[model samples]
Target: MPESFPAQTSAEAAAEPTVLARIEGVVGRLTLNRPRAINALDLQMTGLLDDALDAWEHDDAVQVVVLDGAGERGLCAGGDVRSLYDRIVAGHPDETAVFFRAEYALNARLAEYPKPIVALADGITMGGGIGLASHAAIRVVTERSKLAMPETRIGFTPDVGGTWLLAHAPGHLGEYLGVTGTTMDAADAVFCGFADHLVPSDRLDALRAALAAGGDPEATVRGFAQAPGASTVEAARAWVDETFSADTLAEVEERLRAHTDPAASRALQTMGQLAPTGMAVTFEAVRRARALPDLRAALAQEYGLVMWFGRTQPDLVEGIRAQLVDKDRDPHWSPASLDDVDPATITGAFSDEPAVPLWD
Candidate 1:
């Protein structure tokens, strides 16, 4: 039997560690504990997760690992962009890079961990949340799960190696999802390769208990898995592929305008609300990532692009401010139209080296 449960003091939830760690029989569990913030990862949380994984990797007692979040909101909402914004506004934008270095490193670590890591991707999972779940060996999503990488809507391109996942998605779905930051339902997540099993939300507890009881990892989860039903997002595949497969963002916009599908028209309308620069760069990044050899290479590429955006003081700042800080939902994006974005600038991000290399 396990020595103790990893539960917080039921009456005093506020006192619990930001990351709650414990061993449940052979399963080592790590719970993101910032329920109020929806478990948005900060550098400290990354360190905790890294430390736990490192400890569990070589421990014979830990045959499996389960990652989850506290509270009803979701697994995670991504990195605390508001905290990132404060650092940028304070002229210490480089500090933001430190967080990404650690977070990206942790992400890569989880993907390649020796032991099977099962991620319970429930509730709101987006941005960094996807980083935690999408790469896991046994990614289990519940009906309540909401997945996305909504960086573009805030004028930032998707980071957290989202391009790699997005690039590998069916047809041009990557471009559509990456550039629009559209939310994905459980079925969409499974169909797009972002997730694996569609276990019902109610069964999650029993599933976790069975895994904790030392059941075979894959077989145990599979026992509880159910079909996720048809993906509403994939239903738009024909239009998505046609509109997003164009050679350039301009071509994509033109196609979106010309396509008769109301979804296409909706996508066109959505694009109008996004940062032109973000949309352009995201399209380039997804295409670039699809050609990269592996997740680490993609991370290295993403590290470069994100650093450039952070230091250059482009749309990311305004986007965060408008959408999050000010809550105005009105971002005055520079180079307001996609036509105004400099192709050279997009290409230059790919060529530039990060001041802090990711592996370092």
Candidate 2:
């Protein structure tokens, strides 16, 4: 077997670490080291990851890169939103903008990366985590993996190129998952096309060992998973497409509210519980993203909308407060109803204004 990634000489073990990196044979492994925060991707983590990926991309010896989280809680929860919330509380808008712009650029880079990338997502992947994993060439999920784009629940639309991924998810399942912040396990993720492979968590070590030994990374990963059955989400496709198939968010919600089907009823209840402005923005963003040429275009569009909504609107703060900050389960929404948002407001969110650049 070939030795650990020898492209970078600094693969030696370290005592104190921010993020972890090891070069084993042809694979460069990056582990998000902030286990205490469930491996949240702060600006520092994003920068480090981008830098490492850039290095690995050009280094011919590194044929692949592996991304995963540490300490077992999950892969990554996303940009440490609580920090962004604190910035908002401090009246610093540029802070959040800078963080997202850099992060989204990283996401776009990953999507367009030339080399093979594998993400072993084990648990609680959400928000920025979705950005990291969704763009990978190979995504592995385990029974412990719970994936979601839950920004709507936290008073933000799903950013980090979420609009792109959700727009492309099988059938209208993306629409349903995006709007509802629904959480799914490995099976559901594989069925919905979010995960490329589903392996038990216990098999990760062996799989990594094989990859480190210069095994065919792609086949090595596939070897761990059996062919999954048709997705449960796939079963709900007809109903999802019909109920969510509307030109506007208002009409979509109305259809959900009026429908008597059990699934529709449950959807309506979840919709009722979410922030009105967030729901409207999310639905609208996903719709607009579908027309974009590619993931980068979708991310750029989403980047513009989030800059406007995250800072100016009270929903982000209130949502974060209730969901993450205070954990009160009560968010006093500003408009209080989706109807309160006018057409101009939604249109303005999508305007191709002077958007913040992804890179300096």
Candidate 3:
């Protein structure tokens, strides 16, 4: 169960017309309104959410913030990666840098928020979406939830403080998930510490209403929460810990190939589809992040890696083109295989000229 917040007297609700903000009694409600795109976040939405959080930080009328998506598909799919692709291809690196800077800052703030934040992650929450919900005080998911940090498939390292979360997940499961871009269900999410409660999708509205009416949000969610059954990750815990525990990607691959489990076979198949260099970098990044002191430090390191990827890597562009723009599901990654990726190149991505500092 998540920690509860103190209740406060109801105040007249304030209407925020843009992006669906309304103060319901003492609970401040904010919705990601871009349903057509599964609420994939953009620069404008990130700024709006950051501004609202800043405003509500000290607003007595807003005792707790309830965040959700406007549509049924999910809370959010991710950041507007297509936009970043376009900007990068257009030689507008500054625009891409600005978006990442602001988005990462927002992620850091959520990690440190003083007030309790309740996020309803009922559907496809991946990448940037994880950034929004994973750091909250109360993260609610449903059986319908599908969560992942699948940046490796797009030739990107999992950003938005992903390395921080992945590094701290139990055992070496983080490496398996990060490198393979595995999508976990509700049970897996809770097992991995990515969510707090498992409320049924149908009960989300009632839960939201209870929160808005100044009822204890944590209690309401707990009341509706149900056991998520068994987690596949938990079932394969031993295999994951043993296979991914290898210090090098080569050793991990060797373990996977030698294992006869169906899961190992499936993981090996998935790895074949991802960008090899990206996977190598992701492995090193997560390994390094495990020793970092805090979320801010992890985000800073990710920013540096992403900027470096943009400047030197061709896989990101090729991966996005094949997966998104071309819809072909066939990315011809440069450096073709993990064995072809230079260890020095992977290290350089981590040590690239530092990005503009994320904080003072």
Strongest candidate by lDDT: 1
Error of 1 at 307 (Å): 0.3
Off by over 4 Å in 3: 1-18
The prediction achieving the highest TM-score against the true structure is 1
Alpha carbon lDDT of each predicted model: 0.88, 0.79, 0.84
Alpha carbon deviation, residue 297, candidate 2 (Å): 0.7
Q: Could you arrange the candidates by lDDT from highest to lowest?
A: 1, 3, 2
The digit string of per-residue lDDT tens for model 1 on 1-360 reads 000012233454457778988999999999999877778887888999998998898999999999999998788888878777888888988788889999899889999999999999998899988999899999999999999988887777788779999999999999999998888999999999999999998998999899999968999999999999999889999999988999999999999999999999998999999999888989999999999999999999888888888888468889887877777888899999999999998888789877778996
lDDT tens readout by residue for model 3, 49-116: 88888889999889889889977888888887777779778876546788888989988888788788
TM-score of each: 0.95, 0.92, 0.93
Whichever of 1 and 3 has more TM-score, that candidate is 1
Q: Residue 7 of candidate 3: its Cα lDDT?
A: 16
Candidate 3: residue 12 Cα off by (Å): 30
TM-score of model 3 (CA atoms): 0.93
Full-model lDDT, candidate 1: 0.88
Candidate 2 per-residue lDDT over residues 119-223, each given as its tens digit: 988888888888998789999998788888888787778888888888888767777888888887777888777789988899999888787777677898988
